[model samples]
Target: MATTILETCRVPAPPGAAANLSLPLTFFDIQWLHFHPIRHLLFYDYPCSKPYFLETVAPKLKESLSLTLRHYLPLAGNLIFPLNSEKKPEIQYVAGDSAVSLTIAESASDFDHLTGNHARDADQFYEFVPEIDPVTDESEYQRVPVVALKVTLFTGRGICVGFANLHCLGDASSVVGFIKAWASISKLGGDEEEFLTKHAESLPILDRSVINDPLGIDTIFWKVIRDVPLKSSSFPLPTNRVRATYILRQADIEKLKDLVLAKKPGLLQVSSFVVTASYVWTCFVKSEEQVDDDDVLQVFIFAADIRARIDPPVPASYFGNCLAYGLAKIEHKQLVGGEGFVIAAEAIADQIKNRLNNKDQVLKGAENWLSETKEMTAIRAFGVSGSPKFDLCSADFGWGRARKLETVSIDGEKHSMSLCKSRDSEGGLEVGISLPKARMDAFAAIFEEGLRF
Candidate 1:
């Protein structure tokens, strides 16, 4: 698990990009104002030596990233917060002052063991993933970095590209769009014209006005933030954490859906995602051998892409965070008992149906979000991160598809799981979970036995 740092440099957007840009945060974006940053690592198998990678691939990556930043200037910017505490924070980009920090490193770790399905030490990944510096106090303003990146060469084995971005800057949909665009540019060797022709529709829509917060949720959220202490945007991953991946084929998803329908035939929102998330949620609850109180409440938290759900409908290409929180709660007894999967599935599905479909319900509890988030910290809550729709594997970057993509941010105390499209099978899904050794073993056993039916 040794890593040697080769270089640390900043990559700026091309001169053609608009400079002195300031984008205000919408209500959806404000929800994550002080939340932990999101980190992702995409592994590609490239049996090449460090010298070759440095001489060829690294330059292309940096150049392509610079070109990609022209369209996503916010990535190279900083979030400026006024120390006055009255004005809302905004992402501001100044041509000469802003650039994304990129770290070049070489890791001697085992590429296969790190990316395999079997459990591996989560801390081993800390070496390759770049860190986002904490907010720094500036006179009259506090500046926070929006994004940072790293490229690690596993000499003669594979290369791992890592990204860390502020959650307030974008959601999964927004970030994934940037990754795909960067890959397309890198694939074409930073050919702006050719990349434009092929990826014209992929460019992000930077207009923040489309996100209408009719309920004044923005003001309410800021007030809430003003009341509570802001959370640190740092990855304090605990030791002894192990991560494992589980694949659920299309058949397994259908089986789970059928199982749920057998008991509740009229359920309206039993999509592939719902069943998959629920099954994992149930397994996680059962694996927690310490929570024996059947009456204890367990909350399930997740985010839903709201591009098409909002009134007047936002464009799918709209950049930045356009998400609504989906929450469901049930007693531990119901979630872990017989028919636990079905129970969990129904609860989550109902929440999604009502939260996303009804505009009024979309921001129903907006005022309570901060307080509830605090309460969730005390209760046993299960959350989900990433989504299968993002399709991280499709980010080819001209080196074939990614060997594996992981949401390394979920390895903390959040008790969250990551979802992605399976690499081996179409229509299948991959689940990445991190937990202590004992809980991981229990979860793995329950996950397998439940699939036998």
Candidate 2:
């Protein structure tokens, strides 16, 4: 049988390999690397557990996924394969992790079909769950992906994502490169907005204050950075990228605090970003379309930080959306005013202000929501963005920050953006976008005009 570059693996490490050999990876390999060659594949001997409504799935998924991964990730970094070498394909992985990589059928089409079904199940669950109550309660305004919902995450389903499996090591780029190549993606014009991310070390580094936690999420994050590489990489990618961090500038934060306090005293504690963000989404939708309230102007999906929104913020950053999707639909006539966009944004802003400030509104509401778990299913944010020191440019454990950072939307259509800060503050952000060509043009026109802060 003939072997191609794509099929061969685990050859003896070549002597005198390129000392600083870069990734055997790149982004979304719609070509050679198919959908996640690195399977964080969890197998079950039995059939998938019976389906409960999404209401049942929501509260349990994050906690359960976290718990499941923690058990599997016993060592320092479970999913992360260390490339702590100058050698080509920089070696990484635990003792037997490699054997698991080999335990697969020659054909992956089987896994794809199975997981595809699971993904459809996930979408069906979302379709049935009530659209989150919009300020206008317009069905058209509820948040949802225009195209596809991924069923990859469901247990017992086939593989959807690659963990830092044995063969390739680095980060999400490895995953993307493999998937893009696999899908044989051949678009040349590109969608950088949906694909801008940098390795942490790529940017000029800065110092900041520390937060304490014994076994907390932040601690785990910093742990991931212990030997974080301080260089950068040049992986050419075709996706939007973002970094994850919680550090807000003192001055920027103070300005925000003042804005919140003037609106309602002592209200700076909640995510003021939500207020501004909701305002952004509302205005963005209204400005683009002429559809009426019945037409549903909803687009941006605002994810709630349900933790801080709770009695006190949870000690850890919980994965999965502990968020609520609130839609804002304006009657067509009301939207005809000259300043309708601003007015719509202000209205959304005011709702958030009141909800967050009305005597620990977030906490009380969280408690109430948790109390009524069975009846609270609704569409929520599933995309993730990070500003972690190196989630973008400095994420190099060695090779360098990934050439790109991005989120794989469960929704097949690319309708989201990832915002990463840039030294080019003149532009102020290195925005990696990934919308279809048409939507990309429309969005660029909006930002080029510089929407108000």
Candidate 3:
């Protein structure tokens, strides 16, 4: 776990990238104001010496990142929470003052084991994660960084690229879009103009007017956040946990869907996401081994991209948080019973059909989302991050595509999991899980047994 610091630099948009910009937060963005920043790690296998990496790879990455910032200026900006209640929070950037902190370092850890499918110590990856600076108290506003970047070289092994971004700045879609753009520019020899011409669809639409909040949900969310202690925003420290990756191939997903249909014939939605998530949830609950009460509730939470579901649909490339919540709850006995997977699937399927797919009521109870979630804080509640649609493995920077990718921030949440498209198998889904070593062992056995016909 030893890592040597090379250098830390501030990377700003190249001169004349754009003028000062201010993008206001929508209700979706405001909800995450007090949460920990989302962190991700992309590991690429490249055999090279430290000198070669410093002389060749480092400059290319920094230059391409600067070029990418030109289009995603808000990423290199600050999240400003104004003291005046009337003035809403916003993502602000000053022409010459805004920049992203990039830290370059080298680690002595085993890249293969760290990127392997087997369970490994969750704290091992913490060295590669870069920390975002704490919020500063300005005269009338609190200023905090939107994003911070880190590039860790494994000497003769490979490199790990990491980023930490405030959720209020954007969601997974926006963050992935920026990464793809940066990879393209880096692969094309840092040619910003060429990237713009070839990948015009990748550019982000920064307009905040497209999102309409007719219910004053934003006001309700702001009031809730005002009572929260800002110190709670600090990132979670590593606990005694082990992280692992599991894949549900296309065939496996099909079996799960069939099982759900056999148990509940008229279920409305049995998508891969629902089935896979349900199976995972059931296994996790069973792994606990102590929750035997029939009435105890196990809550499962996940989010959906609402860009296409909105009334006047927002652009797919809109650079902000536009999401709807999907929550499902099942009793302890039902989740740990002989037909746990089927029952969990039915619950999740119904939730998606009644909430997520129902455009008219997608945001129906959003005003109480934060409060309701807080109430479940003491229960056995778990959530999922990322989505298979992101296809994060496809991100390439002239080197080959990422050998492995992880949502490192899930380590901060209690028993949360991450989902993404599989790197080796087409149409397959990858699920990342973190838990105590003993619990992880139990979950692994349950997961494998459930997949067998």
Candidate 4:
């Protein structure tokens, strides 16, 4: 399958948008300063005329994107580290000219295979993601685009809207909100005024100061990550690594939950997420061969949104990152041994509770934890990205809802998995995981066997 680039252009905010706006980064935003761009793809099947898409649909998408930017002005700007400034870098939305790069392309790939619910090669989705290159000046100050978009028409089958956003700009919730807003506008024929009036309830709060960090977390975060070098290659996964999507049906999820409750009858925190995460973590550990050191620690690192947990709660629609990472650690033997699921679930649930209960302390100690953990070269780490809570399947443009939504960028990273609610919206879950080919096969076996009560 080959993808051909047709055209590339910039889509700026609509007229009368606030000009020369500078939004300071909070500790949550700066914590992910060196992280990779978040890539997401939404595939839609429109078996209609190519002329219809080019002449009608394409123009609406571009126009709607412009209007969407009017509300999300920061996305049209860049993140720059200003020279001689004591404060950390910030997002600057320059008035008239700043815009997001939009690439128009065409692909002849198998649309069904790419969007199918089953597993396929992780690398295949890379072609649909656009490259977001951050430019650096002679003074060594770096300026990076906050977002880039690509629209590809899969000849005679469907179209895909590819998104790439710098993690610092926002979290998954913010990005999905942006996408839904764009789609809503596109469906309404790019009516900016109608979009504003109709979806008035969903407008994002761009102010970042509400997240009062009394502990000076922003400074601590910058100091800790400033020296860590950026990844040399954007595409760092080994060739042998592969990605697959696994489903946890509603019945299976409930069964897992029941199993956890059976072991600990008083366990009130075992939800689908906790149980599913525990199952995956245990399978991952069991798939790997036993290590010489039984005491080696296996860590499960996941993030939680502090939007409503903080003292002065941040708005749900607040734009920018508002997440705190939660870590759960267990010795290798204990993690793979019998009763692993129960132990993992208990630890994860407890950690989550602790994080919420001591939100301030957690935020304050985040940098310190990173500093100490970075030195542990031998510890094994696993993390879960993307959440089922972010109902991505409901993102509907005019034509229809997305056939599939994928987190393609994380596939290249080791021991990282993506989770989202099932497309059917039946209280099930869809998990995208990547591993060495052999380990993936072994993990599949363990995943299936463990669920068979």
Candidate 5:
């Protein structure tokens, strides 16, 4: 395959170390693939070893060995986690796919090179190697391996710090360039990064047609507000990384259903976005801004399992993008309407019904949000995950069930939000939520109040 020309430069010194691929995540590492270490993990490194990432993508990808693998085949839609939930998740090797089968470990050590079985031993997985700058003799970059251990195993502070992979998965090619640039600087003696980044921000914040939430950043807006998925939108993946997983809880789900019941029927049977909506509002949708008549809008967006919701459930293992929208947008007054929790419940439910039931529309209008090309139109977007056909509750490793599972996200100049589910000490569900620092503080306060109400 041919290569494209990406911007390159000497690595920066001292304060100007080259930026490496910022992605990080330990997929099979946590939740151990449906809570069973026996299941396979298609582990992959950051696609950061390449040069000319921005420019030569087409050529390299054309010549890429994976092209020999198979077409861009979407994974199965109805296939639940743990393949067999009652047991651990395991995938037999299949030929002709870029995705690979993970070899299970008798213990987690199979995944990480660490000493002793100490909780901190997982730290070795995050060991970043430094890249020397081309300009300065100083190593201009340090790409530490990421910590893929369970967040619950760590403090709130630690999970808060695990944003690197999130950034990487969001854009893998960029990750490739970043790491290569760093490697070049670290080993080739160049500026830490293509000088553009160092001088780019200082140059200007160009204003254009793009609009954003009041917070003025894309990630922040996605944090608290729920978003719906586009027809082709992907499940959570890091900015520049490849692997990802989606996990939820059973009991908290019970709490969600109860909240929705106050308003509409067929809710528990509604889309996952519907279930997630109640949690989003109950946790923090209370009038952060109401004076200007701008009632807080919690836009919930996620895919509806169109395959199953319409009628008989799709085959237990049916795969493909058989999903539609569970889109809903509610105003704060209506969300916290005077009628009480019952009122709030009904209003949000009504909002979801309005979207899903409207004009035979599911995305409400988000089509290009997941576009693969620039020519693709950009759809107006809302944040909410669609419902899943797979069983999140049953994802068990040989150890029983995943003690904890989080829909990992990465933070940048902006931030992201994902879900987490931990097994109860007694082997049930314990849900945990993570958002931007600014918002999480507010969420804690609301959780305190939610428990009261």
Candidate 6:
């Protein structure tokens, strides 16, 4: 697919939002300071004239986004690490003229194939996602935009809205909230002030002080990230890398859960996540025949939300990162063994349970784990990224809900999968997996055969 940029302009926040403003970063936010920005693209099939979109749809989207930024002003700001200040890095919102970059473009790709459920070239989707330039020099305070957007027109078919946001600003929950609010404003189509006032409850809370870090994890996290070199985004993927989406119907999910339970009748928790994740992990490991080595270790790492787990529970809508890492390590032989799926399920479930039940201990362990494994990377790791709880398909932008939603950012990372609620709303699950072209066929076979068993 080829994309041609038509125009690029800055969309600033509403009036009075352009003053020098700074919001302190919480420990939760500090943890993700060095992580890559989140990239998401929502596809819609408009089948309308481009003229109509330019005159009506595009205007409303831009205006709604501008109004939306009033509530989410931090997104229109910059993240800075001050050299002279003793405090941690903060996001500075500058008023007057500073704005979020919005790029309007056109693509020549097949809209149907791009939005279809089947797998396609992962590289094609890259053109739809906007880039957020990172600050390279850390000597002095440098300004970097927290968000950027691109809206690509597919000529006569539809449009794709690509959004990019810094990880330190918020988590998946915050991103969903912001998108929904923008869509609601676009659908209402009236006085922006009255709309915001009417939907006042949708606004996010920016007070980082509410997140009390009694253990001083923020300082430790900063120290750890400061010493580590920033990761380059230009890393090349294997020549044969491919991306595909696999759907596990409700019946398939139940069957997998039953299979795991049948193996170990004493096992009490075989939730959908455990069953689904374990099945995918097993398939991945089995596809790589090299995992048969007894000395090799396979690790599974995932993040669990700590908003409700923390003392004085943070609100579900609390803006910023609030997650703890869950790690499970096992020998390669044990994972590829006959009862691999069952064992994997138990391990993942136990890790999640421990993190939830022992929040403080898990946080400390994560801190220590990061401190010890400074040289290790995710090349040999397997984990899940998106959550079924996010319900991404429901996001409507006046026209209708998205025909397809994808986490294109995961394409660069190996052995990482994206999960979300199925579009049918039938309690099923959608799993997006990326792998080498040679292994995809094997992975698909194992994935299907394991479920059948």
Residue lDDT tens for model 4, 1-453:
599888899988888888778888887888677777888888887886667877887888889998898888999998876544455788988977689899988898999888875556777787888778646553645677888899999878999989988888899889889989989899888877898898888899997777887788788777766665343226554446677778899999988888888899886668788888888999999999668888988898888888888777888999998887777899988988898888999988888777744756556566575564454324688888899787776777786878787887776555778898887648889888877778888988898887775
Candidate scoring better on TM-score of 5 and 6: 6
Instruction: Judge candidate 5 against the unseen true structure and give its global Cα lDDT, from 0 to 1.
Output: 0.29
True-structure RMSD, every candidate: 1.5, 20.1, 1.5, 2.1, 19.7, 2.4
> Which lDDT values do the candidates have, in the order given?
0.88, 0.28, 0.88, 0.81, 0.29, 0.78
Candidate 6 local lDDT, 239-343, one digit each (tens): 256778888999999988888888878776578888999889888998885643576778888777788887767877777788777777777888889988888
Candidate 3 residue spans exceeding 4 A from truth: 232-235
Candidate 2 ranges with C-alpha deviation above 4 Å = 1-300, 317-337, 344-348, 356-360, 363-393, 410-414, 430-434, 450-453
What tens digits encode model 3's per-residue C-alpha lDDT throughout 324-355? 88878888887888898888888888888888
Instruction: For model 6, give the 10-residue run with minimal summed lDDT.
Output: 230-239
- Model 2, position 18, has a per-residue lDDT of 22
Q: Which stretches of candidate 4 lie over 4 Å from their true place?
A: 83-85, 138-140, 227-233, 237-239, 357-364, 367-369, 372-378
At residue 53, give the lDDT of candidate 5.
29
Candidate 1 clash pair list:
none
Clashing pairs in 3: none
Evaluation by lDDT, superior candidate among 3 and 4: 3
Clashes of each: 0, 61, 0, 0, 72, 3
Residue-wise lDDT of candidate 5 within 115-178, one digit each (tens)?
1111221112222111111111113211211112111111111110011221212122222222
lDDT of 1 at 395: 92
